[model samples]
Target chain A: MTTAAEFQIEYLQYLQADGKAKSDLPSFASDETLMVNLYKTMVQVRAYDTKAIALQRTGKMGTYASTLGQEALSAATGAAMQKDDVFAPYYRDYAAQIQRSVSMLEIYQYWGGDERGNCYQNNPHDFPMSVPIGSQCLHAAGAAFAFKYRKQNRVAVTTIGEGGTSEGDFYEALNVAGAWKLPVVFVVNNNQWAISVPRGSQTACETIAQKAIAAGFEGIQIDGNDIIACRKIIGDAIDKARRGDGPTLVEAITYRLCDHTTADDASRYREDNEVTNAQELEPIKRTRAYLTDVGFWNDEKEAALQVECKKNVDAVVEQYLNIEQQPLENLFDYHYAELPANLVEQRQEVIEGSL
Target chain B: MNELTLVDAVNQAIAHELASDPDVVVFGEDVGKNGGVFRATANLQDRFGENRVFDTPLAESMIAGLSIGMSTQGLKPVAEFQFLGFIYPAFNQIVNHAARMRNRTRGRLHCPIVFRAPFGGGIHAPEHHSESTEALFAHIPGLRVVIPSSPVRAYGLLLAAIRNPDPVIFLEPKRIYRLVKQDVPDNGEALPLDACFVLREGSDVTLVSWGAMMHETLQAANQLSEQGIQADVIDVATIKPLDIDTILNSVEKTGRCVIVHEAARSFGVGAEIAAQIGEKALFSLHAPVQRVTGFDITMPYFKLEKHYMPSVEKIIAAVNHTMEF
Candidate 1:
């Protein structure tokens, strides 16, 4: 049931459950080497997720959250934007960060409790991973406000879950963005759960995107698991804002196919039927199948892509796991322009106490 | 020098900062054309232009957030909260964002912004207008809370806050804004936020306080001096990152201290000063750190505001008692 929009449903089936891009996407990638690089990045990011889960099982990371199920959504949405466009992601969007040159090792380091993991050689084209619910939206809006004030065409995109819209900052940021007509694309990744609370408990509204109208912006909902649909949704919104139409609220209706995080056990609160059904609509698998029907399927190419993806991940894992852990003194750093006396005292005590 | 009241000095500071630094912009509810609720920002728009001084929407968070946005982009912002009580709506942005922006950015971003608000009891104002919540902000690491007691200090400290490279919380004691006047230095003076100004030195005891309470401390000092008990009046211009050297040095010399503040007695600015003295100057002191502070009640409306505040009587009582120990 494709509408007049550019989104295609069957094209969602070309990718495998394992995250390989289907054959049809090759054309989109071939002409734009950027897309192929984006594809490889998605695969590696997924692998990184898998490794993080494994690491968390043994106490390497503290309460790790996953983008395992939303890899395609992040990749497709990120792929639609260029480097100059700003992305403000939640703690769960390392997939988007990787494409922006936020190193895998840094992600590992941050999940490992190091702010240095957050440090980037470049701007990473993203604001910091916002930990507080919906706070990043304000930062995104502020960046867009800055861009608008300077009359820049660069779009600032921020992501939040359904639960985030309930935060006061969410309403505040939305009001500011809409009032100022800032060039921002707000993607509410309706992942259906905030921690143990389900989306239904967050709001009575059928969709978060519709809330945008109340805040003075047009709202749209799309199947987040459908790559073509996601790309079309994000691309159109970006274009509209670039032409100075102000902001748009995009609700990418996606499911958290995996448990919310490594620490989560969906079996406790979520029914098995729901997970199984969502698994069937995994964005990567749908894209691969769509490519196969479009003459992009071949066993050799699939094997090669897997090897190439795994090789990159393994190399990164080696680099990440082996990077010297952040020194304890680093905890006291990065908090003030001038290191206050108390912090210096605390740092010294920590060093001495550790000794 | 201008024969200005404390409120006039604040208005003067806003006008002077706006004139001196093109980057220094001032805005809050009714700050434009209306000139702020207390007229602290009166006539700034006419002098500095709307771009340099103007009114913000009724939203406190937006006012603070917009300031953060503006400051990060190179504008020096002096954001006002129409009243101390109304400032809580923007507390999150102030505490979580503005306070931490510099440290979070690894010093790459310096939030040279000042939050100006009239605080403490005395006026029979609304519940939120007569609050002494500077202690909450002073406790936060990256923030420097400066409380001005008189016209002279207000002009100097307000200017220094603007030039200071960090986010400075300039808490204007609403009660004292028009209560007093003084000979303000011609060009004003810059006082370090981490230092205390010893207003009057004595050997029997030191009276330590800031903001509105400093007036009461001075009054108490005058009262103590009348009885031949030498009293040192120490004005803690800056509350956070307390001026430990000055505090300890005074206590060591006088061997006694009476901390004063208009906030509720429990965990107010006085508590920090007392605790620090207890920890660092305990052996040097002749008695436990005595604290004269406001009653632990929501400030009453204007009729009882004076009684609700810590007074010369209370400070005199605390100082007299400390002599027993």
Candidate 2:
């Protein structure tokens, strides 16, 4: 008998839970600006998440999905990509969207029931934050297909939760990306829970990254809580994609330290002990501890960073609150390039009827 | 000018668009080396090369999402579903994403993709192959559903759909894909969308139909003309954002109206036409609008497809009933 297929799923963990690296650090870890920038971005995203939850509690915004513990995943993935590369991100990727130049104010506007929130000015290639689970994965593949067809040296990166990986769109996208050899990367934030359902119930596969193996691509797992591992692994995958080496599936193992959304009460399904343990392994605290251990950050810098992040978030919130309600005609206007005659009458009807 | 069937005209139009625009791409199942299932994209991959015209994985949802993504990035992707019934898997991408992309993005990004599917019965295809679900697409706020009843219209309307800035669901009548032949010039002239073409002039009753059903409708009109009951015939090419002005004008001239369609009667496109006629042209002093349509049931297999479809007799009877009133 001959062994036909042999496969292995690689796992990466650079920084352990206590903020200690098990081995020698990559060269990029020594770059002071990059290290501090990652830490600061995680802090900013955390502050933004707290403020968004507050706004939702006060009835100022819609129910928001929080990236409370998965900050390193977004920071690393967003920072790794080139400017021209497109990002088809899911709703929980607020940190990544901000990195792509989708302003925090715009994200605020979106959660506050405004369409203009998705209108990106700086990074025009990035798609609006997709709310319908795993649908953006296919969009990423299509964008990659366009790049490959046009011979453009660019890659498309999409982020999704472990729950999104279960959706049929995820597999279909990966299948196409693999078969076509498109320049795309799928970053699965394997946060242990998909609403009330835990990761155990999501799939029978040992690791979500292994799901990519059946699709004919390299699949790898990484310590999503460790910024160094995230940055290095995702940056390497992106470079490979940009070099036309085909797609990669990256399952960043992390935990959701918050409720699924502001609307969810995770305590009903998840035990307090589990949440407590996961909190100890949270991305922001681990990165902060790593910075402290290296003497690159101190108590004074940590306090000042917190205050700065709060100030920045508050400024964006103020800007978001000042925006007036969009006109009613805006609803019908953007539906088509040129409003047809029937819609013209319909728009007038809406105006007259409102009065 | 070459005389071609509706399917051949569809191929010609795709070839023209791919030749004229560097950004236009055509992809679907078996659309490349095997051509399309219906051959609507025959010889396209060979003509435009594999990059411009290609085959996609058998996943319809991915095909739709891919088109939406490509369209946002300045490519005009004309994706074909092997058949209309297969499009249900992709309905989410069509209705939720592609249709709403422009509105959700506040016009900053728009999908200019054309989703083509061969629809309607009478082709003797296997189960789940024949369907006429245009009304579902027409009801979507941002989607434009256009169906062509003839070769000339197929060539022109397909070109127009490829050129339109918004997403269009171009439901080609597969039953008529090879049924009729007409002169379709290779000049790349696109006909206007959201307009109706008055096929015949009459004074008594107006007959409205679209897609493959137009054959029975026009036949009935000609037969009705022989009986001294002159019937005005209109082919509603664009089902959504309909040319109500033309339909109303024809209705006003001919006080009686009969809407013909092959889709189910309940909440079908015929119902919309009837409701609009009652709303605007009600006082024209004629009979209540009559609808000659298919029954509300799953489109049955080939054996009973004829019984499910509207026939010339059914349309003529409706016209006669309206004229007598």
Candidate 3:
């Protein structure tokens, strides 16, 4: 018998769930200021998610997906990316979006059912939050193609739920990325549950990261709850991609602590004990513990950070609440670069009918 | 000026754009060394190099999604699906992303892409290769669905679709890809997108069609002329943002109309044209508008393909019925 091929998936972790170092820290962890900033951003995203859920509960916003337990993954992914590189993010990637210069107010407006929210003041090349499962992967591949074709030193980053790995678009994206050796990173937030479907039922594969192996690329698993591991692994993948080393899939294994969205009730499908167990291993508490133990954070500073995040979230919510409804013409204005003659007449008809 | 077939004209337009615009890229399943299955992109990869003209993995959804991503990044990507029927896999990407990008982003980003697919029946090909499903895309708001009949229109409208600052579904009528040739000037002139072309002028009745059906519709008009029935032949170049004004004007002048298409009869482009004519030109219309279209069934394999398509005799019969009425 002859063995034609062999593959192995590597698992990475820097900090254990108890806030103790499991291995030597990556170089980025030595940067106290950068670590603090990432920690602060994750805290800020949690604060924003809390307010967003409250808005939905109060009927002020649409159904909001809570990024409760996955903040480390989102924040680390965002921090690893450069400003010029494009990001195609899924719905629960508010932390990444904010780090890319998309404002909290804009995200609020987006969930509030307004199109103007997608018109980011900065980060114009980043794709708007794609709601469809697994579709953004291919978009990232396309962006990578453009970067390679133009000889630009940029990489495209995209994130999807572990469940999205089952989609054909996901595999198609990986295949194309590998075939073209595109500059892109695929980060799968293995948050255990996709809505009500658990990771075990989503696929028979042992790890979501291994799916990239079939596409002729490397795939690795990381402790998604450990911000140090998340940032280091994702950052290395992005750097490798920028240097034209092809694509990599990083499976950040974590747990979804909250219901899929405000509209869903996790209790209906998941056991209370499961949620209880997952809460103990959530990303924020361990990161806070590590930060505090390392002397980069203290009770006074934590209180101040919480206060600051609350103040920022409150200000953005106020601005979002006060924003006037977009004009009716806005509906017709952006449908094309120049409105055609028929559309011109149709717009007039709609305007007159409104009158 | 060079005599070019419709497919040749398509190649010329894409080649011209690739040469003119640094951002214009061409790619599909076999678009690279193979020059596409129909050779519509023949010699494109050779002329433009691999970076500009390349082939992608056989995934339609990826093709559409990639085009959207590239277009947002200041590149005008001309992505092709091998066949219209095969484009169903990419429907989600096309309808949800490409068609909605500009509107959803409020103009911050827009997809400037041309999703080209050879569409319509009459080619003696197997199933899935011959189906005119332009209505599916025409129903999308931000997508411009354009089809060209003759070589000249193929060259001009394809150029327009590629240059238009929005997503366009450029459906080439494969049935007549090499059926006829005409002198097409490679002058980079683009025909108007939201307009129709008046092919032949007459007064008795209006004959409305586009794509492969335009071949049979024109033949029917000529046969009608032999029967002392003058017909106004109008090619609806752009199906979406349809140039109903031209059809209306012709219908008003003739007071009778017949629309022809090879796509399924129900909820098709023909139905939209007929409805529009009824809406704006009801008083001018002397008789009920007639439609000669394929049955609402799967576009059958080659053996039964002709029976399923709208033949010249069926179009003539409908026009004669309208004329008699």
Question: What level of docking quality does candidate 3 show?
Answer: high
Runs off by more than 4 Å, candidate 3 = none
Model 3 chain A TM-score equals: 0.98
Which pairs clash in the backbone of model 2?
A: none
* Candidate topping lDDT: 3
What candidate 1 gets wrong by more than 4 Å, as runs, is A1-35, A81-85, A151-153, A292-298, B11-25, B46-55, B66-75, B101-111, B183-189
Regions more than 4 Å wrong, model 2: A1-4
A23-97 per-residue lDDT for model 1 (tens digits):
454334333344445545566677788888888898867678888778767877677777888877887777777
DockQ, all candidates in order: 0.36, 0.85, 0.86
- Which candidate do you rate higher for lDDT, 1 or 2? 2
Q: Give lDDT tens digits, candidate 3, residues A196-315.
A: 999999888888888888888999999999999999999999999999999999999999888899999999999999989988888889998888888899999999999999999999
Candidate 3 lDDT over residue span B63-172, tens digit each: 99999889899899999999988999999999999999989999988899999999888768877888888899889899999999999999999999999999999999
lDDT tens digits, residues B104-155, model 1?
5445455678888888777677666788888788788778889878888888
Query: Looking at candidate 1, what is the lDDT of residue B147?
Result: 88
Residue lDDT tens for model 2, A1-355: 9974578889998998989987888999878889999899999999999999999999999989888999999989999998999999998888788887889888888999899998987778889989888999999998998898899999999999999999999999999999999999999999999999999999998999988889989999999999999999999999999988999999999999989988999999989999888888898888888889988899999999999999999999898888999999997999999899988998999999999
How far out, in Å, is residue B310 in model 2? Answer: 0.7
Score residue B76 of candidate 1 by CA lDDT: 78
